[model samples]
Target: MHTEHDWISTPITADILRGALDLEHTAHGVLPHRLPAWARAQSTDGQLAMAEAQPSGVRLAFRTRATAVELDALPTKRVYVGAPPRPEGLYDLLVDGRPAGQASVSGGNTLTIDMTTGSAEHRPGPAGTLRFTELPDGAKDIEIWLPHNETTELVALRTDAPIEPVPDRGRKVWLHHGSSISHGSDAASPTTTWPALAASLGGVELINLGLAGSALLDPFTARTLRDTPADLISVKMGINVVNADLMRLRAFGPAVHGFLDTIREGHPTAPLLVVSPVLCPIHEDTPGPSAPDFSALGEGRLGFVAMGEPEETASGKLTLGVIRDELARIVKQRVAEDPNLYYLDGRDLYGEDDSAELPLPDQIHPDAATHRRMGERFAELAFTADGAFAGRGA
Candidate 1:
């Protein structure tokens, strides 16, 4: 309702967005989701909804003649009730596929979550402005990667010149599903996530389905992969299944088969790479249902501890080592009949040797440097000449 810099407002619409598979128009603004609205409706769990709307790997990509651009958005920032304060979300801008600038919006909404009690409270805040000025002109492609951990609502866009969606450059699309590591947890920036880095290195469009505290090999998730048009597909399994203590060795095999079956229903021969979990020291020999370690809570630090003992494995408990072995065995057996199907040991990306230098900060997720390393490894292993994802036509 006010005037600033002779701003010409551009309505936020679906035409100018990428990475997001769907756009949901709300009364407040347009919310982008990795999963479509239909798929989201199936899960009433509030956690999954929040994760889907967090905009991990989601970006607004367009070509504009403008020298400056300002995006007005309402970001729903989460706060752990007793944990250390999280840094403000970072929005990275790229012009002509190169780094342009970085920004962060202040005074948006806050969702306070008390994990111990399983309670959440939401408080309204204000819409904040993020501006990028002085760009190299002459109709260049611009991408604004949203905060990977925050749920951002696209309110309005203001530009000095006209803008339009960037035409597809015909990059193969890679659809990936995994745990929080793939969700960019503990990552320095949105574009720095392993999948994002690998997508860039491999020259593929990324649709990241890596949901934090999720990716439990659900049929709905498999269906989403089946429906999405991806030239290459990878399902990083194990961690969530073990961490949640959702299934045992007896059920794990059939569930994996079912999940792959559902995805193959549509993508019968797409290079479906099955990735096992990376090395988690705590979860390697022990199982979970991980618990919070509150010893440092007074210092505002929250840590995790494995809840399952070594002896539990005898009763068919799941652990990182066990999951990795099972994933390899299952994939080896299946690949005999389905040559297009493949497997990648997640430890190849990060193992005990790599961990000695770049340890998981929280004993779970990889640090930014480790993420970069993992991305590079994935590009070499999966996307190179004659790799598992070599002959792609999904």
Candidate 2:
């Protein structure tokens, strides 16, 4: 019931792309990387490498009048062993910077991951095509935002009309760094991530450094943040450190200071907002190194529980409660010396009241609805007049 048009296959090259800092040509196609090649070389582990290449903010952007389009991609979708099935990785299409349509390709491949065993299995599959038909006539910019959580390889781009690079519109750049939540945890798609959504609402170009399981106040990450150009910047702190129980109180404060110091080294006056972690009742009072809820595992449900007792905090263990207090203190102390520095409590984005109505489904990551709430609240706080980062002119 479909008729074929004369498809123009465009070269899948980096010159026609944005958001991705580097692209690796694979045997089958090209893999987009959010981090640069030099930074990727400094990856300490496979986890960091995977997270860096996940392309949380990467998109294929161009201007065209194509009525129909086809994109071939090979995506590695993750399936947690013994856990509930995850949604398929979604590909979102945008025309003239407006949402147009979305699609998911099945049979492309799958990655079965066993968290308990720390192992994974990859089963190869063929590249799947995403087709978009009946686009409105006339020239308009189109952006295809890849799935944030899945690793995708670009194979080919086909459109009914020729496409060209999108012209710059002189939008302010907003660079952000955070953990999984900011990295698109439980987000419906890549373009809907809190940072991405907030960027759209604020009309800023996003340079997201949201590394899952790896936003541990790393010196290199801070250096990357310092080097990236931006009109506004934010760093959502505390969640990953608390969940991983990576550092104790003694080391946490100094590490934060050093991280901010590194960023200030390059962007001394850029409007920088420091955000604390959103509420996670499990870790609110209890110190963490959160562990899996085994009871839920039988039902193929994945959830976490705070393993460390609150009493352990006296020994310098960090809890979400403790981290919030510490972050507030650090920001308050530093704001006097750095006038452009500002702090926005994470609870303001997702407070106790909101959590009561829209609880975190995994006892950690918020659901898609909550992601929308957080993004909306952030835009109000950071972009509106008289808000923390509102005074600066781009």
Candidate 3:
């Protein structure tokens, strides 16, 4: 049912890539990295390493008359040693800034992880090819959005016609940082991630730093935001800190202040918005270190449970509700001196009412529809005429 064509190979280069901070040449091909070498070198946490390598917003952007396109990529697939298999990573195609097609590759290296033991093992495999055909005729801008949750090494690019990098369209660059929810967890594809959808609706270029389980207020991460070139910036905080139970109230306030201070160093007058956690009943009033619920493992479903006690908040434990209040207070205090700084309560994006209509399937991450809803809501609140991110020239 399939036939091979005379494909013209084109060397993949940095000029055709977008959203990635760094590109590393691997044995098979080039791997996109969300974090620079110096930033990655500062952390030994395996979670941070994996998250940064997933390339949530990375994509190939070019103009071509190619009616057919083929890409060879070796993706490092992840598997939980005992959990149900995850769906293959998806690649989304956009033509002239509109959704056109989607595809997935089959074989790649596997990284099996054991949650209980915090151990992992890697097994090598070969690259797989993805092909798209029957595209419209004439020259058009084509963008291949890489998988947000997979560590993909781009091997080869081939097409029926010559290709060239797309010229800058003068879109405003929006750099956002957040947690797993912002990292496209449970989202249908990379381009449909809340931030991606919001960027599309807002008509801005995106550089997403939504590191899963790694959005802690790290100095290096702040430094990364400080140095990156962006017209608009936002930092979504609280969810990861509460779930990880990484710090208490005493440490959280100063950490947030210091983080904001670092970012202000380079972007002195850029409109900066700090977003608090969205509604999550489990850790809203209660504190956390959340843990996996193995009771449903037999049913091929996994869920999370908050491990901390509600009373623990009396002693300075973090919770989503506490975080929202604190974040609002901090922004109000800083706004007097820093007129460009602002804040948005995450609930405005995904509140209790929205959750009632679309409950989180896993009790933490939003479903595909929720991602869309959140994206639309964000565009309304932040990109509207009188919104915080409004009035920026594209």
> Top model by TM-score, which number?
3
Backbone clash pairs for candidate 2 read none
lDDT of 2 by residue, 327-360 (tens): 9999999999999898999999998999899999
Per-residue CA lDDT of candidate 1, range 98-155, in tens?
Answer: 8889999998999999877889999999999999988886999999999999999999
Query: Which residue ranges in model 2 land beyond 4 Å of their true spot?
Result: 1-3, 391-394
Query: Between the candidate structures 1 and 2, which one is better when assessed by TM-score?
Result: 1
lDDT of each: 0.88, 0.87, 0.92
Q: How accurate is candidate 1 locally (lDDT)?
A: 0.88
TM-score of 3: 0.97
lDDT of 3 by residue, 272-373 (tens): 999999889899988999888777665667688899999999999999998988899999999999999989999999998998999998789999999999
Q: Model 3, stretches more than 4 Å misplaced?
A: 1-6
Q: Candidates' TM-scores?
A: 0.96, 0.95, 0.97
- Higher-scoring candidate on TM-score, 2 or 3: 3
Cα lDDT, model 3, residue 329: 90
